[model samples]
Target chain A: MSLPLSELPTDTVAKVVTLEVGQDYRRRMAGLGLRPGVAIRVIRRSPLKGPLQVRVGHTDIILRRSDAVRIRVEPMPQTRGVPADAAHPEVVPAP
Target chain B: MKRIALLGMPNTGKSTFFNRLTGAGARVGNWPGLTVELLSARILLAGQMVEVVDLPGIYNLHGFSEDEQVVRRFLESQPLNLLVLVLNASQLDRQLALALQARHLGVPLLLLLNMEDEAQRLGIRIDSAALERALGVPVRLLSAKYGQHYREALAAIERSLKAHPALRRADRRALEEDQHIEQALDRLVQASVHAPVQLPPTLSERIDALLLHPWLGLPFLLLILFVLFQAVYALGSPLQDGMEVLLGEFRRSVLDPALAGLPSGLRSFLAEGLYDGVGTVLTFMPVIALFFVALAIIEDSGYLARIAFLVDAIMQRLGLDGRAFVMQLMGFGCNVPAVMGTRIMRSRGLRALTMLVIPFSLCSARLQVLLFITTAVFAPTTAPLVLLTFYVLSVLLAMFTAFIWRGRYVNREPLLMELPPYRLPTLRFLLHEGWRATLQFLRGAGGYIVLGVVVVWFLTHYPFDAPPASPATLAGRLANGLAPIFSPLGLDSLLAIALLFGLVAKEVVIGALAVIYSAGPDQLPGVLAQRLDAIQAMSFLLFILIYTPCVSTIAVIRKESGDWRLTLLAVAWPLTLAWLVSFAFYQTARALGY
Candidate 1:
């Protein structure tokens, strides 16, 4: 299922579908290796709605939650065994 | 002279490479814009003198950010002999995309794979020969920090310049397509790079788990700040005292006796005006140096970016980027560096807003005067409370100012900063950074400080032939003219004049007060108590806390912002705020029968 990147559970890998934002933001993110079709791992998220830490290739970047919400991502099919915590995702997708 | 420009993605160790190539100490922080302006140094390479320009880091030539525009404009205007593209070997996937984009810029290029040691540690290796063949440029793998493979890079640069390689501009439309760039990066990475399939959890990730934790991160940040303040005080105070004593003794024993042969007016001018004015600024060098050393270590270790990540939400609410919080922390040490430190902020609006709020950070100079007043005017038990209140007010005022200024324009920049892997800060790098910051501070702000002191000295000393010139001079006359304006805050002519002299530098206020009252430092408290009641004293302290920044700070603000209107606002806003706040405090205290 495709969702905003901010809704992706920590440790889940996903491919960027698109950045549903302004051209400038998309360009800036693209320069940082956040281009569409590129896979990224949601490594961590701050507890109080802070920035999300996403690993893109070998580089780790912090994105504000607001910006993260604008980035569309589709979950990658699990290649390794699915972790039990994946069953109970922490983030609820924005309605 | 032929020109070569260093270009790369942010945090790719471009400045470090620039420092190595030019043997210049260009500022290199983990964050961006340490080289905000174009910095060029003349170097003799292989018997040819070439000007090497360190351009601000840019993600792509077509990028819209200010730094990218700077790079774009320079590339368009300057006739370059060679373009050196620096890349982080550990993150070659993204960095190479920038390299590919720059190659299309039609500049003759030499690609440098910097930070090869980190790449090696990560079990990532790049075949530079393969990459060079693929990109059609000479490529060298180097660790600029360790000076690895620099000679080969320089030789290649010389060769590239001599050969005058053909320039081919990349298709602008092709460069604009995101998917096209990504596919090209994938192709380049697959052809030339090798890495372990499953990397271990890195040290940086492990540290970030704790440092960026929601519950623990804020407290950790506070603890770091607490420790930094303690370190600055505990380490800096003894050195400050020692320098103070040494300079005082030299003035009394050597300088005064040597200058006794001159006319008394000239002697006083040389001793008090020139020496003492500059000496006051010099005495704070140890503290300023200590602050920068600690800041450098924090920045180099990559924790500063984490702090920015941690505080982005809170700072955003105040209409500032998270980076402004770091600048505010630096302001507590001294606002001059804090103002210059705003160069790191990429947005002009953010820089201006951060600079505006920084003056309220209770810098060391203002703290000294507040410390003096609190200890003198209040009881022992209440002194600490008063001092704490002043600090709290400083922060509150800064936030309030930011609150008013936050929505002036809608800031569209997202917080998309790279979290660089942590590395231990080398002592040599730390000391060099500290020394360079201190020298920059002195070189930029020292002249204004000296001028201010000499001007004040002349104002107080003019009509020198008059005996017992004591506060009856032109400065005194001017102070008397302005006294009624401050009378509501319980300031007499002497207190008013001392504050006027404080425009030179805040630290001189206490000394100016001492001179005005014709009392020794030890007798200051008694004279102060005799002149004013506790309420009035409190009002005066409040005024000192919020008044206009010192002359040096204004000079730096002007230099950094390049805006006289903003500099005028910097002076006018604080002065107005100081008066309104002090007046309110004094009136409220009197109405409440304090």
Candidate 2:
């Protein structure tokens, strides 16, 4: 189902199924490793509001809550329950 | 010799196309007067040498940006033996506008439609011959990304060049056919080329909704900025530390003993002064290089365009556009190229606004100041925040200054920009661009760092008098004199000495301090290794971030704007704001308890 990132619960890992965003915009997101079928680990909801920092394919790409809404995602199976921010900083190979 | 100019919008794979045609010999560089310059190369066709020029990408040949003028001028001046107009297949309408413009220029043209593979994947199609009949030129559907269909294009060019004498239009019949041709395009599209041109999915709509929301966007944008700065601090520091170790080894192993056997004066001159000055500053190259590499990935992947789009409204409010914001982002890497890049903006007013605002972006040299200061005072826990705050302040200062400057200059153009489809940036290209940027930074700043060190050395060493009473003897006193003007800004000590040295090159500020602080009065060095305090150090960093950009940027501004008045304004306004902001920070921090 469609949902804004701000509406998505914290610590949700989801596979991006589709993005209603424009082609140019999608290309930009895809550049940062957020493509259809790519796994995204939602990091933190700004205590103030909106932009969410999510780790996709090892790079942390920030997206506004509104853009997050156009993306359709199915929650991934999660057992570790590790918070995005508290997750240990690991050096992912540069994309 | 024959001539063909490959022209189109930015990110249309023009550079890639140029690379494919000429390999590595094309003169590729940011334009001298513009951030994006036209590239010219020679291509050999069937044993005949033909010159191929790649003009800077332009949405139109009209009055949008400076590069547009360059493109318009080039087209107007020469009889292009054949105009090779490359259009992104996915974005045909806009690309067609340029094709129409080229046709109007009265040159025999060929439409090299690129990105066909992706366009076809998305279910788009083109009746190549039908389009050719409609536009009165040949159309080649080739994917420049993979080499498919490229040979055909080469063969077409070779044939066109060989038949060059007959290719030139003899009369106005072709020009008069354009209106009839326009109708033909409509009818032909209906009959032959049928495909879906749906808006490609993008996060921009949602991001723009949130980012442009009156209430949410600004704060969210700020928060993202906070995180970006935090990342810069978080990621860049360790790299910087490693660089420092390498520099230390170099100094200890090669520099120190090499000068030891010389006369005491000469030994100290080369060792403590020249070697120390340049070496100390150059140590930060690793951090600068890594930052550019990260930025290049973001840029090449096209994510950077989305950022400019998301922030366009805010920038517009400040009298700029998304393109201008892209240049501002590049300013963080270096203001010289950033200022030059203002050519991407479509309007003269907007171009000037972007150039004027660039100095406020915290470049790598300023990062050296931030890293050195924050590490000195706050523990790692607080250091990131201080660094973040400095960056935030610099941005705020830049925007506020832009707003004030906008009172004088304004653009009436719409902020609408074409966004290229995002693809993953290739690793090979990213590394190439990263190394290119790094080498440029080193080449531009490294020399100044060495020169600054030697000059400071001469000022300190040549004075035959007894070493004075102050910690900094000769040059130190001069710096102290200059320090007072900056003292009201909260950096009273010989730190002003370091800041003055920075006027030569920002990175040298730390090196200047390292030398001035390390040496003693009697010209006999003291054992105490001194460093700057955190609070005052932060103030110094803040000042450097806001100061006028280096001479190179000023030169670019003069060339781009064609007016010294605007250039002088760009230089003066930023320095004034920087001085004011640093002063306020210093005074407020002292009164609060720091």
Candidate topping lDDT: 1
Residue B101 of model 1, lDDT score: 78
Q: What is the C-alpha lDDT profile of model 2 across A1-95, one tens digit per residue?
A: 64444455666766566777775455345334355654556644433343455655324455655577787766655613443323322232212
Instruction: Give the CAPRI rating of model 1.
Output: acceptable
Who wins the TM-score comparison? 1
CAPRI grade, predicted model 2? incorrect
TM-score of chain A of each: 0.80, 0.74
Q: After TM-score superposition, what is the CA distance of residue A93 in candidate 2 from its true location, in Å?
A: 57
Q: Taking the tens digit of each residue's C-alpha lDDT, what string does model 2 give over B201-301?
A: 34543554465454575566556545554564467667766777877788789877776687777777767667666665555455555555556655666
- Pairs of colliding residues, candidate 1: B104-B170
lDDT of 1 at B75: 69
**Fraction of the reference Cα-Cα interface contacts (below 8 Å) that each candidate reproduces:** 0.64, 0.00
Off by over 4 Å in 2: A1-95, B28-36, B62-65, B104-106, B165-184, B196-296, B299-302, B323-352, B355-358, B361-392, B408-413, B435-474, B480-493, B504-571, B581-594
User: Which ten residues in a row are the worst by lDDT in model 2 chain A?
Assistant: A85-94
Q: After superposition, how far is residue B61 of candidate 2 from its true place, in Å?
A: 3.9
What's the CA error at residue B319 for candidate 1, in Å? 2.0
